[model samples]
Target: MTGWWCASRVPKWARAPIPRWRNWWPRGGSQGVRSSQDYVRKAGAAARMMLVNAAAARWKVPATECTVERGVITHGPSRRRLRYGEVAAEAARLQPPQDIPLRDPKDWKIAGKSMHRLDIPDKVMGRPVFGVDVALPGMLHASIAQCPVFGGKLKSVDASVAEKMRGVKKVVREGDFVAVVADSWWRADQALQKLRIEWDAGANGNVSSETIAAMLRDGLADPKLPQARKVGPNIPRPTSTTPPWSRRPARPG
Candidate 1:
């Protein structure tokens, strides 16, 4: 006699449901759903903006000339069709938003469904053209130096050795900041490395975190501090007995 045995292959995770039948909600739960709703509500707006911006990367289309409808993008007159995904790819390479009149809602299509963002690939690939990513011919690198203390005045700076450094273009000193300009960041940094700046430090120089805490505590301790609220006509007027500076003087006498 032969005995029959059944064999089955089971997944390692099949032994139990995740959370052991706790009926846990999916990740992103309510908040995720809300955020997603917000994203959808704004999707058309984002697409409307991106369509024209992306169009310029390829051809001249006014922002009002292009729109996203049903995941496809249409440019004005030509009715040329593109996927939002495609537009997003093109837009990731484009400059920051410049006004192109946007298509109004009455003229829209493709904006309502939950679809993935068009710029995802560029962001994932680290190829997004952000402000810091812009490159122009003859562009120079710049870094700012400022007084470490508030309201400090720059005394003087010695740039003799710094001026001699290779690749140093110019040292620009504005009221509160000094910019070391050069052909390249490394060179600018090198140029600044040789300079020394002095400033007239202000009152906060000797102030520490501990002293600030004490001051805050003392301010809070003064009951008058709360009554001194600057907002609205409800502010309590100072009485004659109050400090001279706190009360308006009676007359010139």
Candidate 2:
């Protein structure tokens, strides 16, 4: 109850009180360390408190008198000691306390220090699985071709040749692109290359450097255009500004 919702996924009958430490990392920008560390710290403290409460109940002492260190709880007055694993079952039954105070940074043993990365061994041994490494039983591969010109549309595609190519499964065409599916990526790529396709290059296809330069010049001359910055009123405008290309180059000595 004290931890995040995902803590519920941890089985109550687990042999040890362990936080879901793996979920702390940011995955696909979903969460950052700054945001996750607080939750993890609080949840871990709550779990430790539960174990301490369970041990205190067995010893017939107040939970506050118990101190936890390295998974072992010790009662100061009675000299009683209990391992977290020994009280894990009873602790699981107890409702987690709310708003457990985090330990002081000065007392931290591992955090804010260099330590061995848990993922290094698996990565070095090439044992870690990735998205590209996964393969399914009947998975197909596809190769796509998009219009070469900007603002162009797909006009026509003669897929008869590509459809008959070896290992080619299907040929699909959309508004601006065509795709060839096959048993393998290479076969799909080969089939896609064989297809005869046409694209309708719209008005933008005729755009050239001269047209772009003219547009920039028009924008600079327009008084209605938004000014990037106006430090003060009554700023003097330059009578003329030399274009970079129009300037003569220095002669060789």
Model 2 per-residue lDDT tens digits across residues 1-253: 2232323333433323434466542344645445456765766777888988999999989988988776678999988888777998999899988768888999776667775667788899998777656679999988999988768889999999999999998998988899999999899999999999999988787776677767776766677843522224555333334443555656421
Quote the lDDT for 30 in model 1.
56
How well does candidate 2 score on lDDT at residue 194?
94
Runs off by more than 4 Å, candidate 1: 1-114, 223-253
Candidate 2 has a TM-score of: 0.59
Q: Which residue pairs show backbone clashes in model 2?
A: none
lDDT, candidate 1, 126-209, per-residue tens: 987776667799999876678887777677788888778888899887665676898888888887877788776777677766
Off by over 4 Å in 2: 1-31, 34-40, 47-99, 207-217, 229-253
The top-ranked prediction according to TM-score is 2
Tell me the deviation in Å of residue 212 in model 1: 1.4
| Superposed Cα deviation of residue 184, candidate 2 (Å) | 1.5
lDDT of 1: 0.59
- Candidates in order: C-alpha RMSD to true structure: 21.1, 11.2
